[model samples]
Target: MSTKIAACAGAATLAAALAAPAFAGPAYTNDTGGSFRWYGQFNPSFQSFDDGQEDFNRLTDNAASNSRIGFWLEQAYGENTLRFNFETAFGFRSSDGVNQLSTGDNVSWDRTNIRHVDFQFDTARYGRFSAGQGSMATDGITGADFSGTGLGASNAVADSAGGYAFRTSAGALSGVDIGDAFSDLDGGRLGRVRYDTPELAGFTLSTSYGTDVLKDANDRESYDIAVRWANEDAAGFALDSGIGASWTEETGKADQRDISGSFAVLHKATGLSLNLAAGERDIAGTYAYAKLGYKADLIAAGSTAFSVDYYDGSDMVTAGDSAESWGVAAVQKIDALNVETYLAYRDYSYADTSAATYQDANVILAGARWKF
Candidate 1:
């Protein structure tokens, strides 16, 4: 290689060597308790339809707001430190295959994009606080643990489990985007405050409250409160689980309520993991989730994983005939990229016989996401 090329290679290696420790995971590690990390990720996926019924044939297919990219920065300082997380996803999209374009085109995005943006600070003895437009604290974002980068069967559990409902209740103003936390699921103009207690052995607790400023004419929305307690790292077996609830105050009548809970267990020596999540949506609906997963590191990349999940909900909880569903998938990581994917089949049951709808629907998506 030329002298210039060798020089450039040397500089790149030196830079990576110097930057590695600053961005490693877990801000407070060991006695050092200080560092910074910066990382970005990109994921894009596509779909092909085989909708044999309803003349669902079309021209082109695109993944809509499914593509994403962004990065995060975190640092620790003594008993107190600072952290910043910024991320965004493809805002909105339209599909082009067999009339699917109409479905994708209507999904408009106003202020919501995928790059989740937020910053956090630790008050040490006081509390840890987070601010900015970031992930919704609703039951789903806080409780749902579906492995994929997309929403899945976890919603059924989050909505029905009573203590972990995925934040899909009242603040729902249909006039906005799809994923906004307060408006739709896309994005919302809101702020959140979270406080966590220091852990005692394998136990800790947390509570969070949030709402959108533009929600009410005064730009003030209802306050959603969440509480979680977990027990873990006991004996040599590790386990973590907790429950939470959210309530919205109405002007006159009783308040709307959502509650949810989840638990995970790991047999460290055997590499076995199991999880269960449940949610309840007021008097309107219910949700439950059951899953089993295994981790084995015999391969070159060290570890591989597999899992299965099932969920059931009330009639109004999910649309159609059965309101019951299940999904399964696996993941393998090699070097800079890990390939993971999942597909779920939903059976929607109907309460009214006079309705016309697709009795059974299926969704399948699989792809790879890379980070650097």
Candidate 2:
């Protein structure tokens, strides 16, 4: 193995060896049956990148799931309940934010790091209503995955080393980044008001309208609707799926529309799973992703999971462009320590009919996540 790979493996081993015990902190309760709790997780990774012409390595906060903290409060009123949530990231240097030209660490807290600040009310008979700076109705609709290795490999292939520029066949920078070519067209969080219907026969409906709240430069308004279903059978098979459509428009600007969905299935008896996702944008073209995974109690401490995934996208950054990526990952869960150690390898390639041919890029990531 290369020195970089060896270093990453050693770090992962050390992290697992020193894993701390799980702790959720104290949950305070009131006489009225109200409760409050705080929680968070730290996700750090060692990333090594080879962009055809050069190589770069860094220790960074995993963009797959950045370090974050949050608080939840809940109260019951007969058959109904009210809840509040506040969450934010730590604003650390991110794996995907560094590139050949900008390798220096950049870290600072900002409003953009705020993930959720919202209120929700749930009714047993009616449904659920939410208002806040949080997830839109379609958020994560295209990312459903039963694979335990999702922390390292998923539909979001760009999260691994997005900022790295692709090199042309002539060994020159193409001025285009990986993130521009490979997009999942997935929904994202925003300031919004949403409603979700009560589950009926394992299916539920949701909708939302929202706009940018933390960023001052955005003027678009967004709307979306989604449907989700989940079920488990006595035969030890489980399935989860969701589909959604969203639209965003800004005065005088061309409106954007997208449709996306994902499904995952697991066979408990065989510890085998399958995940599939697909999406299309009115202007950006389309993409599809798939992952095959297996999990088993290979160790006494916890389960070991392995997966391989692939992504293919077309016309993401510009018309006539194609992007493809593939990866393999493994994760080891330490149940007693609330920690997950992982190692992943991914390869990316892009092509454009209107531009010079580009060389492929490869990335290696090793990390650990600890939740409390």
Candidate 3:
């Protein structure tokens, strides 16, 4: 098996092997044991655009939120429990019908990945703490709002001139997904510890602290902190929001700060949901995305959903310039097949470069996926 598949499978086996015995001490009691879960997805999309080549395919085991797939291990030991996850996957693109894999596939181990060898421990009075490679915990919103369209990796805040072209995919590792989501901040893997308070009635609170997993020569640490609240879903509607920041001090870089916040309210009744998010990066500038969508009862003998998204990131600071972009898509589910089509456009400009000042780009996507 390939390294990717092997790692993914090994992680899964470990999670299974950790299961408690059918009958045992306090740790294996019926009240102290929970089950394990495996989740996955495959999203392969095609495209046609105005800038880059048209007609391409991209697949990720985890889509919907960011095309992520992994197994979650949750065990109960009285009032406290523990959880862990692991996943192995890569980013792929296609043109015509050819699968064009990138060379970075060798190490995308950290790109668009959901499981980063992480673990969470919980105790009734002590709250919960999680550590390992993980996302900075805060308002739970950053970059393109998890559009699952790869908004920040290959595609970030597009300038007003070029626009943050939706034609470019951002996935999790935006740069490499575009230029290279594998290096530096492509889902920059670091150390994170999170503490979650016990839920009271219908509300709970959480806080986290994190550090850069990969440090520069100077050995400075990137600090992350934030808090969030959540309530049990009510009448098919749920809400999530939070705020936090990232700061680092080192030799080659000035200690910079990033303050980000976002809120989302979801309703499942009547097949509809709206997502709105906006955030600012001290170094990335600023980026925000909004989406409104609905699942139709039926269309052409199949179930379907339509949605539109708008993005703005001209405020992002770059050595070159900035960009802007937009995207729209419709997904249809037929029998066991799910198909989706999308179109995107971007406009970009240069602030310092003397060469071509701008580029107008566009892309169209089509994809059909099935699962076991």
Candidate 4:
């Protein structure tokens, strides 16, 4: 364990020394106020997991923010604007895909990897409307954080080593994996039509109806509604919050419903922040998450951020089940190089009404993200 830590530290130091600066050029604009641009980022990491009975290590793409590329086009007409967006992942081996039996599986390019292929129209007074494959109304309602450490830490606990299963006290593999017990209950993208009301006093309302269009699975109807707010006070304090509800139903299946929300506040002067989130599923589960964070200009390169978070969940996988997790992370920004390097550690524990006792699992991740 000591040797692995030392090797990771050495590799991080070498990466920092060899990092090069990269930047994106200005967008191309026409005489009629139309513009086009391309963007992307790469996030890769070295991860280690200890599942009580065994240890595992691998180099994989960060599931929090994987490598991706995108393009955007926009045109303006008076107070209204029309835009199009297209984004997709690079299909690399992911951190969450590795496990005790396999190192990892490199995903191939497919329609499911396409994040956004949508068109939107926005007006100053009437609000906005969107169509095609894109985020639903409640997409980010459960992930409000201002700590600048989201690349390494967030409300989602399963993104680190979710595939690894817990071992029983008798050194046998437990059927449950990390992902099965822990979830943020966040909304996702789909082939949908959405509408957002214009901001009024820092608050906006949104709604959407969609389905799974990228996959060939059983089709289910999904609907979502959400409200969001953001504001800054005279004392240099910033606040962001959002709440949302979603429902899904399919033939011959039980209807699934969930409500989730999150709030975050930051004091610019001190660079201290707090974030909280909670959610409940109609079927039979609840989860709450919290994080305390601090950031400072301690380095000439850019800002440095640190955070610690905890998660408590009940009845997520089955009745009488309890899941708990905690993690700490640090991120350093290199503004000149358009890069951010991070290190994070997390521990997960699970319990249930069963007679068998399950052991804990822990993971360590270190990596860098380069944006351009």
Candidate 5:
């Protein structure tokens, strides 16, 4: 097996081995026809990085969501429904397959970030409201995606090499952070209360208020509002679009605000897709991203997609510093194996030549994803 497939399969096998004994019984069910089901995903990838001075390889978790297992519970209430979901997972280093629960090997192996633990009430007519830890209104609305290229090449550059360091022409480690400087501010999920309005003529509105995860001190809080329009496969075309704004305030600290939007369109007949996203932040200046792709049944029993994406961020690092990122990628889906295999190449460069520590970098990523 290729490195990608091996890692993907190994992660799945390990997860299954660990989860099987823990989930031996039937899922909880009630008399009201409510049911619960378990679901999970395992994605492992291999990335090669060239910092313009030296090259290295990294075996890591998925650049996207990592590996996870969760449960969904549903309860019927007349025409409405009450739902609860719980999910938790952790990342493992591919190089050694070592599971590091927490730093300092602390007194308690209190590892793992609780990704989601929420309860939702959905009304057929009114809308949906959710409480507990979950995504806010603008969580994923701003970084729109309609192409398969998100696995390796997207506006969120951290997914691929979240820990990699940049090397300068002098062969010295650059102090500038690579992940934040080159990547866009993908929205974050927080412990929040959210309300989403029912779809009205392909439009929906949502709002949320959240306290920071861990309930940090200094009275930290966030609020978000978003509007989205979606019409899938209507008149041989599909559209998904959203716009959102957010504010974060902390007593005695600089308040941060952001405005972000994205649109994605697809031609059903030709399998052609286009996506664009733009955002401005109080600290990170402004950034824009665009992608073009085409999907076709080029392989028997599979669909293949080719795409190119570009991103430009002005003053992304500091005043008068800008970053440019571009990539080309291809993905092939094998339905028989229930796997998606991808290969992608991306380049990163900064425009501030005055800084001796800033330099160009190149990255290549290959990965496979299995979702169940």
Candidate 6:
């Protein structure tokens, strides 16, 4: 009888502790003063593509903005915040055959893979420190662009069906294909330890050391350092800029180093935005990209943006050859519905070093993104 009475008392105390003021709202807080909540985006898109051969329609996962679900936890201790985030994403694609939802087949969530799992500690005076599988310091800094069509303009195309073969004007298969000379060298998410200094005078510095950028078994370390700056208004224009560099040690291979930077400005008064970025890697050559975009009040509660971009890569292949790509993209942002629809057309041409021939590839892509 005494033992039963003690158990009842403990249960009541636990219930009371959960009802504390810190446990308010949808998120739940435990006795340890930590709160946890779930957050994620379900982004699905449909696309019609001209894969240089037959025109086919596909309902695909947006390559640029992948679908993900995750949860976050945080606890405040003194002047510091302790946080944790775990995120995973689906790898649904039309070419997955059995997993394509539109084929009346049972979709497989088997490939829902882990993307980020990290713990962070942040202090106002000491900045932030993070560890685990997450973004490196140099990630996304070089390819930063204010253009609304990031899903189509930059390396995001690789997430889609842009890798399909190209057909020549004569309806014959061209030797070259889209995404062959994609000049994307930004250090992506990796298992690493990273640190960032507090923003001072609109500038922040960061550095990260990782096992490998691609998580490959190279048994070498990757080091990245980056600096970023942002100003709401630089004189009369809004400015965002950053520069980053990375060195990757390759086992039994030549060590690789990459340098990249980007600058973007937007004139709010005129709705004109310009973006410029460049990246270079030793032995891999160099590439530069520029984009000009405009946002106008042509739609009610929405803005339309038209953008044109060009890429030039010198010695992208052999010593004397080069590759070039140009494209046009347009986006309509409906703020009321929180949706953005886009259309893009791109043309690629490259020097065929093996055959000493020049070939071209072209594609047209369209999609819409709804944020929830």
Candidate with more favorable, higher lDDT: 2 or 3 = 2
Using all chains and alpha carbons, the TM-scores for the candidates as numbered come to 0.64, 0.96, 0.63, 0.96, 0.86, 0.80
Worst lDDT window (10 residues) for model 2?
Answer: 14-23
Segments of candidate 4 deviating more than 4 angstroms: 13-26
The stretch of ten residues in a row with the least summed lDDT in candidate 4 is 12-21
Q: What is the C-alpha RMSD, rounded to one decimal, of candidate 2?
A: 1.6
What are the per-residue Cα lDDT tens digits for candidate 1 across 239-343? 666666666554555565666677666777776766777666574555566776666765775356666776655424333313455555455444433322222
Model 3: C-alpha RMSD to truth? 10.3
Error in Å for residue 194 of model 6: 0.4
lDDT of each: 0.43, 0.90, 0.44, 0.90, 0.72, 0.68
In angstroms, the error of model 4 at 267 is 1.4
How many angstroms is residue 83 displaced in model 3 relative to the true structure, after the best TM-score fit? 2.1
Give candidates' CA RMSD values in order. Answer: 11.4, 1.6, 10.3, 1.6, 4.8, 13.9
lDDT of 6 at 112: 24
Better of 3 and 5 by lDDT: 5
Worst 10 residues of 6 by lDDT: 95-104
lDDT of 4 by residue, 1-372 (tens): 677677655555554554344567368999999999998887878888999978887878889999899999999999899999999999888888888888755666878899999999999889999999999999999999989889778989999998889899999998999988999999999999999999999999999999999989768889999999999783699999999999999888889999999999999999999999999999988999999999999989999999999999999988999999999999999998888888888999999999988999999888888888
Give per-residue lDDT, candidate 3, residue 99.
Answer: 24
